[model samples]
Target: MNPAQTTSQQPRQDSPHKRADARRNHERVFAAALEVFEEFGLQGTVPQVAERADVGKATVYRSYPTKEDLVEAVVRHRLAELDRSTAPVLAEAEPARAFETYVILLFENLARDRLLSEALAEGRSSRNTGPLLDRLAALMDQAKTAGRVRPDACPLDLRVVLCGMCLQLINFAERDPALWRRYGELTLQALRP
Candidate 1:
């Protein structure tokens, strides 16, 4: 092959503009999926998500071929956002405050986004939560040591309580929005030593 032909045969890198467009498309797809899933739960279809995103069905399928794939992707995305929001608090020196802040953030996220609440409520297993659970366990241990948390209050108990409260809010928020704040306050009170 000629020298010029050799250069042409090499794979081309995506231009900056193309990369930006891809990023935007990704964001749009993710946002649309969240909305669709929120409105329809796991029964939401890919075509519906694609329509909501204003992109071709092929575009959505290119990233996630099945509804399950889309749901998993959306869950992973939400989990990442949760992790980012809680990371700073988890790093703080005060374990009780950190744990409280983390729980509050979780409650707030669940209240604000029905999609995330649904995703979490589905009880799908994802490996990403292991580290988060470990961190929470460490924080609980610290709080127990500091006399902020009760000796019998384990990390799993905290998770179960907070998650149950959030699920209740999601289930009842349509009838009464006040339930979210009320349950949140009650949760905090119950968690305290």
Candidate 2:
């Protein structure tokens, strides 16, 4: 190869590395955001996440411009995870058990995840809730057909009950992690046929 051509055509090796570094930074910021929000709910701050991730605030802002944007992203990611976890519960042989298990799982996750709990309780960013709702509704219907739940049980009814439970549990669940499960059992009992 000609010397000048070789020099002029030298690949920008740093470009790929820069892209990979950017992706790693994004993943770090996302994981940090998840941890911060899980602990602090929506009250968590980008600066706190940046500190946790050991990245600059500008780095987080580069990928997520605002707090709301960051929250929406986190919520979407969490919802996807929650949805994935439903598969096993949905596959249970007994309809009532499936419904009850799903409810308990939701309560456990909410009790442990302040941001998701708060977001759901406050009814913000509801678009991503559709799939979970559909799955829950399906389970509820199966339970109803199996003569497990009370006649009036509906998906909205569960949401209302869940929101109320979250409100009651949010303040104390951290102190007593099992409290949400207790409430989940009570909620299940109340729904019995």
Candidate 3:
């Protein structure tokens, strides 16, 4: 083969080591963001995350591009996880148990993910309850049919009740886990038929 022809090549994709390094950096950046957000709320600076991650500020910006983008990405990632965990609860045949379990899982999610709790506390989650309402409505209908919930329990009402429960738990998470646990059951009881 001609030497010049043999030398021709396609551009390289990221190598395995490069990809692994990128993954590690990504995780570090996210971890840093989580810590910063937990400490300073959503207003936490990107530089803070970079410092915490021990990465350059430009690296953080390259990963997230914008503050809102970073916040949105983290929130969505957490919510997606919450959704996956609740999917099984929603699929359960028993309505009351399903609803109760769903709330419990949601409370757990809020308790674990500080950034998510802060976002909820900031009222950013209010605008995105459509899927939540749909799921709750369907579950409530099943529970009603199963004679588990009250007769007048609509999905929207259930959504409001769940939102209230979540907010209450979030407000009380720092002060008292027991309080949230108590109210969690109470809220579930109220939804029971």
Candidate 4:
């Protein structure tokens, strides 16, 4: 075979431009998957996500080989969003205010994202939550040192409390929309010294 023909038959290298395109496609698929999953929960399928993404199903599969992998990716994305949104609040000089703001932000985010609320409610282990938990622990330590949070209050306790409130808020959203803020306030009070 001619060298030119052999070169043409070989797989093309992923050049910088190709990599940029791939990254854009990956983001599109991820955004679409998050939307579909939020609307339909775990019942959403890869085909549906692909349709929403305006990309081929094979493209989605190339990035995320399985539904579970896609779900995990979406979850990680949402968790990262949560971290970004809450980080500044957690860093405030007033520890009590920081803790309150963090909890309120978390409650709002979880209430808005039904799929994430369900995933968290299921209590499944996720590597994505590690950083969020670390942040929470740091916030809790700050609050404790400032004498705003009770001495016995641990990060795990705060996690459980927040998760419990979020689960209730989600389960009763249709019945009572006001319960979310009510529960959020109650949770805040419970965390105070």
Q: Model 3, residue 123: displacement in angstroms?
A: 6.4
Extract clashing residue pairs from model 4. Answer: none
Candidate 1: lDDT of 103?
Answer: 60
Global CA lDDT computed for model 2: 0.81
Give each prediction's root-mean-square deviation over alpha carbons: 4.5, 2.9, 4.5, 3.5
- Candidate models: Cα lDDT each: 0.71, 0.81, 0.69, 0.77
Tens-digit lDDT string for candidate 1 (29-126): 88999888767666688989999999999888777777788887776777888888778767774765776666666666666667676555433334
**How well does candidate 4 score on lDDT at residue 45?**
96
1-193: candidate 3 lDDT, tens digit per residue: 7776545632134467677887899899998887787556566889898999999988888788998777777776767777888776677736556766776665566655666756654432353434555665676677677787888887656656766666665565563545556666776788876
lDDT of 2 by residue, 1-193 (tens): 8998777766576678889999999999999999999989988999999999999999999999999999989988998888788776667647767888888888788777888878777532267656666676788788888888888898777767766677767655452557778888887787787
Q: How many residue pairs in model 3 have overlapping backbones?
A: 3
TM-score of each: 0.73, 0.85, 0.70, 0.77
Q: What number of clashing residue pairs does each candidate have, in the order they appear? A: 0, 0, 3, 0
User: For model 1, what is the C-alpha lDDT against the true structure?
Assistant: 0.71
Ranking by lDDT: 2, 4, 1, 3
lDDT of 4 by residue, 1-193 (tens): 8899878756465466688889999999999999998777677899999999999999999999999999988888899888787777666647756766776676667666777777776543467656666666777787788887889998677777777777676666532435566676787778788
Q: Which stretches of candidate 1 lie over 4 Å from their true place?
A: 1-27, 38-43, 89-93, 122-125, 173-181
Better of 2 and 4 by lDDT: 2
